[model samples]
Target: MLLDLLKLHLCEACSMTELHEAVALGDYDLVAEILRTGRCDPNHKDVDWHDRTPLHWAAAKGRSELVKLLVDHGAQHCLRSDVGWTPAHFAAESGRLGVLRTLHSLHAAMDAADLFGDTPKRLAEIYGHQDCSRFLETAEVESRSYRRTAAMKGIPLDQRDEDWEVKKEELERNPPYSRENHTSSAQKKKGKKRGKQ
Candidate 1:
């Protein structure tokens, strides 16, 4: 396939080769064409560390437009290198707030705790990105408040105001035993004794 051929060509390209050149040096145009044509996988790994994807490079370099393009083409936002750092983590570490925001908007899981128990919010704080940390903190607080209010209203957290279908189904599946059943069985025994008398 064309994708396989391009992967082969890119793998042969040297470490010193610019990714734009590795794709034949057409810059963003060539990268976009390769992605659009499906001639190369944007998720391809370089040979040296095998750790860097095009997305990783784009994010680390703060190439926001290129980052968006790669993400739209299905480049994974959560792909971690051997050291356990995701593209979002790298963006945060590099202080690329624009790239980080773009990734977050794409639904990259900001709450995903890494091996060190550092979510994107924690990473932002550790790396001195106070603005990013503030945004994440506000979002988290709002989400928690919503859940608490829903819980206090006697609603199941899973229901989330969807007419309680999930709660209804749960009750139906595990219906409680009725006192009527026990009382009726007792009455049946007493009537048998009276009939015998």
Candidate 2:
């Protein structure tokens, strides 16, 4: 495995090493040790694959405890992957109701959309995750009042306005499950567009 990882020329953030595997495996003790010893970043992303933080894997895998631990340390629920799939999106798609509940309580953006412009609720419905879809629907109805005034409000707690562009670049640099060259070209095009504007 080490040789394979070395041959892949993957960055530390890539899903080529111990940290990413341990998280995916839901090895709680290993995850805790890795984070506690500062051997791995709690927010490390597999830019090459899932374009997700460890928390996303945990949430999607229905490892609620791991998800909580990851969040308690540091994980941004609002951050989008290459395809704009957030951890919330994955949880909903997988029918991980408990994970969805945890994310909702954490104030994960209930209305955030993916690259296809499908929100988690929309995906849940499309995928026949009835219970998860219902949860999102209920939350939407309950939060309607807040949603009305939220557009005019300042940045919510999880997202940083100043960090968006940097985040975008980072996302492009390590797109979810994309070849490096492919993302590099995309990044260049985006960079050029930014320059033009």
Candidate 3:
């Protein structure tokens, strides 16, 4: 009851143009309406204000719905602020573990470091958010493992790695390099025997 009343009260005082405010205040209705109507660019950074994007605010405040909505509307998940801090940095400092997970799922930069050389996970540990810290540590390890394997396989580190492998197998079934060779040694041997017979 109090939260709804607060939202109503906050929305009343906010300008329709301030998408950042809407995200910070957890006003999903306003955000959805704006995105649906194309009233604003979801990826736009606030130049005159804090220089952060709507996704940044949503992540900082632990607003999962807003973060998901912003990303769905084509927000740049890995965009950095003036201080080189990304949305992940904000989420970690505040112990927003679920927000961190959501950002990672959206392919946000988990390894981005701020001007002080502190990554989101490092900041989480420094700020005493143990769960967020541990989560990021695990995520980092998994990401490194995946990247190393992808490198060894000589494939791009993209979400389409599995699809790439399948496509490669399909291509290898009729490899162009072997196609120009005319025939294999087995075929040559069979031709010689047939000719002799």
Candidate topping TM-score: 2
Instruction: List lDDT for all candidates, in order.
Output: 0.59, 0.69, 0.71
Which candidate model has the greater TM-score, 1 or 3? 3
TM-score of 1: 0.56
Q: Compared with the true structure, what per-residue lDDT tens digits does model 1 show for residues 1-197?
A: 87677764764464423442433232678778767766556655554653567777777677778887877886776665433455666676567778777776665544544433466566677657788777767644554565567669975532121223344355457645543443332234346767999
Between candidates 1 and 2, the one scoring higher on TM-score is 2
- TM-score of every candidate: 0.56, 0.69, 0.65
- TM-score ranking of the models: 2, 3, 1
Report clashes for each candidate as comma-separated counts.
1, 0, 0
Candidate 3, TM-score vs. the true structure? 0.65
Could you tell me how far off, in angstroms, the CA of residue 118 lies in candidate 3 after the best superposition? Answer: 0.6
lDDT of 3 by residue, 1-197 (tens): 67655654554353333677778789999989878766566655665544577888898899988998988887777566654667888898788999999987766657766544678888787667899999999877766676677679996532332333454466567555655555533235346767998
